[model samples]
Structure formats: C-alpha cells, structure tokens
Target: MRAIVLGGSFAGLLAARVLHDFADEVTILEPDNEQEHRTRSGAPHRDQLHALLAMGHDQLERFLPGLTEELVDAGAHLGHGEQVQFYIDGKRRPTVPGIRMIGASRALIEAHVRRRVLALPRVQVLPHRATGVRTHAGRVYAITSVTPGGDCHELPADFAVDAMGRSSRLGRWLEAAGWPAPRIERLRIELGYATARFHRGHELPDTVVAHSTPGPASNYLPSVCEPGALTAVEGARWDVVLAGYTGYRPTSDPAAFVNRMRRCVAPIQQVADLCAMEAEPTTFHVRDSRRRHFRELPRLPGGLAVLGDALASVNPVYGQGLTLATLQASALHRHLRCGASPHLPATGYFRRAGAVVDAAWQLSTTADLAQPHVTGPYPFGYPLVRWAADRVTQASILDAEINAAFSDVLHMRQHPRVLTRPRVLLRTARTLATHKITRPT
Candidate 1:
C-alpha cells in the first residue's frame, strides 16, 4: 500500500510515522525545506513555551521508544506536569505530583519528532505543494501538486491524509467536488499572546504559572523553566509566555510586554526588580476556537481523512492541540490496523477520533467560556461544570485523591467524566463544605 501525508509538521510527521507501519511507502508532502527540526517560519509559535501533556508524552514514547530520552540526551528538559503551579480564575491550586511531562521549546519537540519520523526507511519527505484532490468514482485516487520546479503533477496513492494545521483548505476542495462542506463550530475567543525568555544565571526559575483573570478581565499565563533543565537543545535558558483572552492582549513592544507580564510573570521574577529580560518579546494571536465536525458529514470519500487541527482547533491556551493530535493519530493507527484496503471507509476512524476530541473540546472550551467576555453558546452542564471545577480547585489542595484525579484529567491521562464519579463528587462536596476560601491580598 502507498500513502501520502500533506503538511509535514508535527501532525503530518506523526501521521507519516504511523502510516509507515502499514504501508510499503509513505511520502510526506510539505513546502517548507528547512533542514533543521526546530520550528519553521510556517509555525510561528515554536519560540513560545510548550508542554507535551502526559498522555501525548506516553503516546510518543509508544510510537518511538527512547525518543523522550533522546530529547533529554540532546539537552531537552525532563520534568513532571505537576511541578508547574496551576491557577484557576487567578486562584492558585495544589501542586500535585507524578504526572510525567517534558519541558522544552515547541520547536525543539517538533525538531526531534521530525528527525525520528524522517529516519524511517519507508518514509520520505518531499518538497511539494498539494493543491487539490482528484477522485475516481467518488474515491480519492491522486493528489495534484506543484513541485519545486513549478511544474504541476498528480501523485497517485492508495490513501491521502491531511495534517495541515488550522488554516487547512481541505473543506473547500471537498465542497468544490460536490461534497457539502463539513459543519464547523467556531467560538470567538479573541485570545492574544506575547512571549520572551529571561534568566538571572544565578537563580534558575523552576515553576510555570498561569494567572487567569477572575471575572471580566482576560487570562494571563507566564512560565519559567525548571532548574537544572537542559537548555542547549532549545537554545534558551528560560522560556516565558504571556497569554490573555477576550479583548485583553499583551503588547509586542518590549516595555509593554514587560508591563503585561507584571504581577503575572514567574515567581522568581515576581519582584521584577531582580530578574533581567534577555530579548525582545514576540506576539501571536488567535481570534477564535474552531472545530470542524467531519464526523457529522453525511458522506466522505474513502481514501481521504483530516487529522489534528484540521479536524478541531481549540484555544491554544489550553495546550491540548498536540496531545489531542497524538490521540487522533493513535486512532488512525487502530483503524488502519483493522484493514489496509483503499476502499475502507474512514467512518470508523472518525468515530474513534471524535470520541477522543469530544472530551478535550468540552474541557477546554468550557474553561475558555468561563469568562463572560468571550461570546459563545453555553455547553450543557455549564453551571454544574463551573461549580464542580471551583470545588475541585479548592478541594484538590486539601484532598490528595481529588488532587490526583484532577491532575489526571488535566494531563489527559484520564477521561473528564472520571471527575464526576460518585466518590470523587462526594469528596469534592465534603471538602467544599468544610473549607473556607480566602485570597491573598
């Protein structure tokens, strides 16, 4: 069997890696020719702080053994998810431990993953731009693209997968081919971000922090690297990201970015007077959170499928994209494992992937909509979710089991529904009844 993967970034690389197991030859079609694995110009967020959720971290290890160790060997920082200080609505939560995650620049993670995927003998990364899909009797057969020479050609494949990011144009091509465009759920989030690195050399900041505004104000997230973290691979001593939601956005100007980071920067730098900035700040923004409902489509060609952000993109602030993409790739692997025939419908794959996406979509969007400034339809159980989340926040500090459960959900290691178990709910309620909440002034 032959397979072609479009857009050779993280998702594309993962897709090609998974397909390599089932196909005789798997080709990755990408336009970017940058040889190094670090972030390319197409992915601007590479310079910002990034975390591989425990679930994705585990998946990557399953897909590529020794890959995580290779990253640390190459100077990437190894750490646990619980080491970071977490806050909800500007209120601090317990620092639970044991969830495994790695700390590194997003570019570094991509670069390492890219290297491993390209190493597979059956996998090839080609410099090509996929313009459209051509189908035979309603089944996808070939992809048309323009080579580096500017000459257009059609590449035949038994299966074509799209791993293009959020800006993918797959829907348009499908619509042009007489298939109705898939339904989309879009939430106007108006999220803004600015990031920079800082280090005092004498003191290495060791915790990540996010200070989300309590009421109408926007969300603010700032991070500091772990002490003794390997920085040679990422080329930065520390990584900091300042993020906000709604209309509140951090300025890109150095001084303005510093001001936005004030009171919300890393703990060691909270004094501001002590820590020194290392470089000018860069900015990235997201106008909305979007999810393409491909599973709802009445009919989809058998040979084509969408993965990662093309299927669903939520607020990056939640840091679920990479993890969710890995889950989707795993689902694709299972689907292909059942059958390698080109005529096999992708419905089973979409169904499995959608189940995974549903959990992430609900958790992240519910949190994003917690603030009133972001305009969007309330998901079911809105009030109950808020109440439980609040109680969990306060309860996690005092109750270790609750803390462990909440940490599991946050890391995507367990289903969000686990928090709703009778025992956990009872514990949260009891903790809330006895605990008195107070905020430091």
Candidate 2:
C-alpha cells in the first residue's frame, strides 16, 4: 500500500511514521527545502517557543525510541520536578515531583523527528506542492501535485493525510469535489507573542523551563503581569517569549521586549536583567482558534485523514497544538491497527481523533474565555464551570497533591472531566478553606 502525507513538519512526520507501520510506501509532500533548525516560509510560528506537554513527550518517545536521550545529548535540557516551573500572577506554584518536560525549540525538536522519520526505509520526503486529492467512487486514489515551475502531476496512493497546518485548502477542495465540507468552529482570541534568543551559560543553571501567565489575582489580564515563558533550548540559548491579548501584544523592538520581560515573573525578569539580547525579537499574531469537525460531516472521501493544525488550531499560548497532533496520530494508529480499511471512509478513526481534539479544545478555549478582551461563544453553564475551575486552580497553587491532578489534565494525560470527580473537588475545598482560615484578616 502507498500513503501520501501533505506537509513534512511535526504532524506530517508523525503521520508518515505511523503510516509506515500500515503502508508499504509513504511519501511526504512539502515545498520548503530547508533541513536545518530554522523556520520555513510555510510555517510562520515554527521558530517560536513550543512546549511538549508531558503526554506529548511520552507519545514522541513511544513513536521514536531513544529520542529523549538523543535530544539531551545534543544540548536540549530534560527537566524534571523543580526544574520545570509554573507560575500564576507572579507567584510560583510548588513543584510536583515526577512531572517531567523537555526544554527545546520547536525547530530543534522537529529537525530530530524529521531525521528519525525520514530514516525509515519505507518513507521518503518529496519537494512538491499538493493541489488536491483525486477521488473515484467516494475513495481517494491519487493526489494532484504541482512543481516549482507550475507543472502538474499525480501520485497514486492507497491512503492520504492532510497535515497542512492552519491554511489548509482541504475544505475548499472537498467542496469543489462535491463533498460537504466539515463544519468549522472558531473563537476569536487576538493573541500575540514575541520570542527572542539570549546566550546561556551558568544562568538559571538548575532550571529548564519557567512559565508565567495571568490568574485570579490579575483577573486573567496582562495588565497585572506580562504573560510569557522561557525555555532552555539547544545550542546553549534561552528562548524567551512574551505574550499579550489584543492591543497589549508584545512587539519586535528589542528594548521594549526586555522591558516587558521585566514585568513578568522572577525567572523571566532574571533573563531580562542578566542575559544580553542575542538578536531582535520576532512576533506572531493569532486572531482566532479554529477547529474542523470532520466527524460531523455526513460523508467523507475514503482513504483520507487530517491531522495537526489542519484539524484543529487552538490558542498557541496554551501550548496544545503539538501535543494534540501527537495524540491524533496515536488515535490514527489504533484505528488502522484494528484492521480498518484504507479503501473506505475512516469513520472509526475520525471518531477517536475527534475525542482527542475535544479534550485539547475544551482546555484551551475555556482558559482563553477568561481573558477580558475575549467575547463569548461561552460553553453551556460557563459561569458555574468557571467558578469551580478557578477555585481548583487557586488551590492547586498551594497543594502539591491538587497540583498533580491539575497538571495531569493540563498535560493531556487525563480528561478535564477528571477534575470534577468528588475526590478532587473535596481536596480543593479543604485546601481553600484551610488557606482562608489561616490568612490574616
């Protein structure tokens, strides 16, 4: 069997790797030829700081054995427990033991994954722009491709994947081909962030990751403290990013970026004070979070699947995109492993993938709704949900046990509904009551 994957970045690479277990041959379609740790024209946010949530880290390791060791040996930091820090409204949360995360740039992590995936004998990367898929009797059989000079060709395949990030043309193609396009849901966030690299040596020697964002103290507004994150990435550099909503977004100005960092938490402030700026900051804007609901479609072409941003592009500030893609790929593998046919509509696969998307979407969109600038398409019973969620979050900062449960949900290892369990709610209430009683009036 032959499989074709569109886009060769993290999502497509993982899709190709998974397809290798089911198909005899797999080809990745990507136009950019750059093979280094740099952003490609196709992916504007490739160079930004990306987090591999604990579950994403586990999925990556499972897909590519020894990747953690490979990345660590190449200067990427592997942080566990206290080395990974989380702060809300400038106050650091007590560390939870056994929690692990890898500090690395999106580019570095993708480069390594690309190398490992391409090394598979059954897989190969192609320099071609995919136009659309060719369908016959409701099944995809070939993909139309165009060369650099506008020459068109076709590649036959038994299966195809659309990993074409946010700007994917699959929806249009489906409509043009007479199939009902999947319903799309969007939430306008108007989020913007800037990232810059600084030379690293002995600074924050024991730390690998530090992240700070708005909380109840600030009413989830950037006015109280700058929301940003810093990661100890490869090449002995500290990758710092500052984020804001709507009009308060960070800019590319070097001095202004550092000034914003100074308003952040202690770790980011330390980077601003001690580390010399390596270069001008780069900025990216996200106007909205979008998701394509393929499972809702009445009909879909067989032998077709979509992953990554093509399926769901949530708020990047939440750092859920990469992890969501990894989880989707795992879902795809399970669907195929069950002897599901590539020649028929992948109903089972879409069902499983949709469940994964639901989890990440709920987590990100719920938090994004907390921002003052964000308007509603609020979920059902949002007021009550928000109150309960806020209470749990406040308690998590004080108790390690509660934090672990919260972290499990944040990391995508467990469902958000788990927080609603009696045990968790009971602990949250007790913790909050104890803090309330002990505090000075």
Candidate 3:
C-alpha cells in the first residue's frame, strides 16, 4: 500500500511518520525545497514562540521515542512548571512542581520532527504544488500536482492525507470533484498580531508570561530563551474589527506598544521592560476561529484523510492546534493498529478529531466572546457560562487547589469536564463566600 501525505509541517510530518509503519511506501508533498532550517513564506510564524504542553510532549514522546531529548540536544530549553509564572485575573498563581513544558520556536520543534521523519528509508519527500485529488469508483486513486518544471504529474497512491495549513483548498477540490459541500463555520474576529525577537538582559526573569485582556486590549505571551534572548507576541483586534465590534486595536509603534504592555499583568510588564527588541516586527491578520464539519458529510470518499490546520484551525493564542494535531495522529495510529477497514467512511476519525477540536474551540471561543468587540453565535447559556468562568478565575487566585485544577485543563492534560466537578464547585463557592466576608463595608 502507498500513502501520500500533503504538507510537510508538523501535522503532515507526524502523519507521514506514522503512515510509514502501516503502508508499504510513504511520500510527502511539500512546496518548499529547504528542510535543514525553518523556512518562512510557507509558515510565516515559524520563528515565533511555541509551547509544547505536557500532553503534547507526552504524546510525542510515546509516538517518537527520544524526541524530547533530541530537542534538548538542539538547544531547546526545558522548563519546569514552577519556573514558569502564570498571572490570571490580576493575580499571580504560586507555581508548583511536577508540571513541565518545552519552550522553543515552532521552527525548532518542526526541525526536530522533520529530521526524524526524513530519516525513514521507506519515506520520500516530493517538492511540488498539490493541485487536486482524483477519485475514481468510490476511492481516491491519485494526487495531482505541478512540478517546478511546469509539468503536471499524477502520483497514484493507496491513500492520501491533507495536512495543509489554514489556506487549504481541499474543500474546493472536493466540491469540484462532485462531492457535497462540507459545512463551514467561520468567526471573523479580524485580529492582528505583531511579534519580534528581543535580547533578554540580566535584569529579566526566566519565565513565560501570558496576559489576556477582557476586550479591546492587547494580550502578550512571552518566552525567555537561551543566550539571553526572548520572543514577545503582541496581539489585538484590527481597525476594521474595532469598527465592527468594539474600539480596541493594538498599535504598531514601539512606544505605544510599551504603554499597552503596562495594561497586562505584572510579570509580562516586567519582561517587556527588560528586553531590547532584536528583529523587525512581523504582523499577521486573522479571521475568527474556524471549523469545517467534514464528519457530518453524508459520504466521504475512501482512501483520503484530512489532518492538522487543514481539518480545523484554532486561534493560535490558545496554543492548542499542534497538540490537537498530535492527538489526531495518535488516533490514526490506533485505528490502523486495530486493523480497521481503511476503505470505510471516516466518520469515526472525524468524530474523534472533532472532540479534540471542540475542547480547544470552546476554551478559545469562550475567551474571544468575553471581549466586548467579539460577536458571534452565543453558545447556549453564554452569560451563565462566562459568569461561572469568571467566578472560577477569581477563586483560582486565592486557592492553590483551584489554580492547579485550572492549570491542568488549560494545559490540555485534563478534560473540561473536570471543571464541573462537585468538589470544584464547592471550593469555588467557599472562595467566593470568603472573599465577600472580607470585603470592605
């Protein structure tokens, strides 16, 4: 059997790596020629900060042994949970031991994974622009692409995987091929982001700071790196977004950016002060969080699967996209290991992947909705849910147990259902009561 994976980034590479074990031959279709270092144009934010949560790291370690060691060997910093300080609701949570994460650029993580994937003798990387998929008699037979020489080629394969990023055209290709249109949900938030590398000095603390505003304010997620370098990302809704939603957009000027930094929590402000900018600002435009309901399609063609951002693109602020993709790859491995019929409909995989997407989507979209400017279909009981979340955030500030519980869910190590437990509810109630009792009268 032959398997052809589309896109060579994180998801596509992981899919190709796993497919090699099941298929007789595996090939990856990527447009870029260079693989030694991180390349932009294809993935513009390759040099930006990327966090690998415990869940993602654990999954990668299990799927690809010695992967973490490889990253550490490549100069990636391994930081424990206590070393990283989290500030939420204008209060800093006391850090605890045991929970840990890897801090590095998206390029570094991809480089490590790419090196391993390319090492497989059975796998091949083809540099070409994928045009479309050709299906015949209820099965996908080949992937058509245009080579650099201007020649069109049809690479026949037993199966094909789409790991293309946010701008994937698989939906259009499916529609052009006579497949029913898949349902798409797009929340156009019109957010803008500017990121720059900075050199950290001795005055800066070694930590990661994430500060999210309620609405119309900029949020920052900063990471301190080796050689006293740091990466800072400043994001806000755009002018068009300000006009459409609320008047809240971040400025591109350095001085204004510094002033806005003061609005965030203390730790982030401290980092913002100690670092000297090292690179030109790279800005990004965002359309709201999007998800395509491919699982609901009446008929999905056999021998084809879609993974990664091609499947669902979450708000990058949540840092859950890569982790969810890793989980989906793990799910694919399980399905193949059980000798499941690959030719059957992909509803099962879609449903499973949807679950992963839903968790992250809910967490991110809920936060987006909190911003006064963000407008969308209010999930049922939006007000109540937000109120409850706010209460939980308040409780987390005072209670260490609550902080740990919230952190676990935020890290994707535990499900959101844990937040609804009776014990957590009781703790939240007690914290609220205690706060009220101590209020000035």
Give the whole-model CA lDDT for all candidates, comma-separated.
0.73, 0.90, 0.69
Q: Which stretches of candidate 2 lie over 4 Å from their true place?
A: 437-441
Error of 2 at 125 (Å): 1.3
Put down candidate 1 lDDT per residue, 338-416, tens digits, no spaces: 8756555588888988988899988887777765576568877787886676566567767778988987887788888
TM-score of 2: 0.98
State every prediction's TM-score relative to the real structure: 0.90, 0.98, 0.88
Q: What tens-digit string does per-residue lDDT give for candidate 2 at 375-397?
A: 97999988788888888888888
lDDT over C-alpha atoms for residue 131 of model 1: 93
In candidate 2, list every pair of residues with a backbone clash: none
User: Sort by TM-score, best first: what order?
Assistant: 2, 1, 3
Q: Residue 273 lDDT in model 1?
A: 45
User: lDDT per residue, candidate 3, 29-144, as tens digits?
Assistant: 99875655544667775654565667888888887899888877766656676555565434456575657777566777787788888899888898888999888877788999
Candidate 1 residue 420 Cα shift, in angstroms, is 1.1
| Candidate 1 RMSD to the real structure | 3.9
Q: Rank the candidates by lDDT, best first.
A: 2, 1, 3
In angstroms, how far off is 162's CA in candidate 1? 0.7
lDDT of 3 at 374: 72
